[model samples]
Target: MISRHRKVLREARVVGSERRGTWVYYWVLPPALERLPALLQVPEPAASTSW
Candidate 1:
């Protein structure tokens, strides 16, 4: 499933990766992070105790 997402992102030019030996490393383009909303999305209110 992850590989499928990676392929999509790669085709969209949203990310890049490199394969080394038996491992593959993936990365989101640096500028993309800045364009994204905060990683936590809507902040939890103080009284919200559970996810």
Candidate 2:
């Protein structure tokens, strides 16, 4: 899991991380932050009239 996260961060180039003591913290870079909403959006599901 950690490897996968690292790979994505490296590939995206839109995340910044810092280590404080034993903990590492990450945040979206400014340019990426501006586009984050659109990146995270998903299409609405089709309406279901019958359950």
* Clash count per candidate: 0, 0
Best by TM-score: 1
How high is each candidate's TM-score? 0.56, 0.50
lDDT of 2 by residue, 1-51 (tens): 996887698579788888899997887789888988999999999988986
Residue 4 lDDT (model 2) = 86
lDDT of candidate 2?
0.83
lDDT of each: 0.82, 0.83
- Shift in Å, residue 35, candidate 1: 3.5
Q: Lowest summed lDDT over 10 consecutive residues: which window, candidate 1?
A: 31-40
* Model 2 regions lying over 4 Å from their true place: 37-51
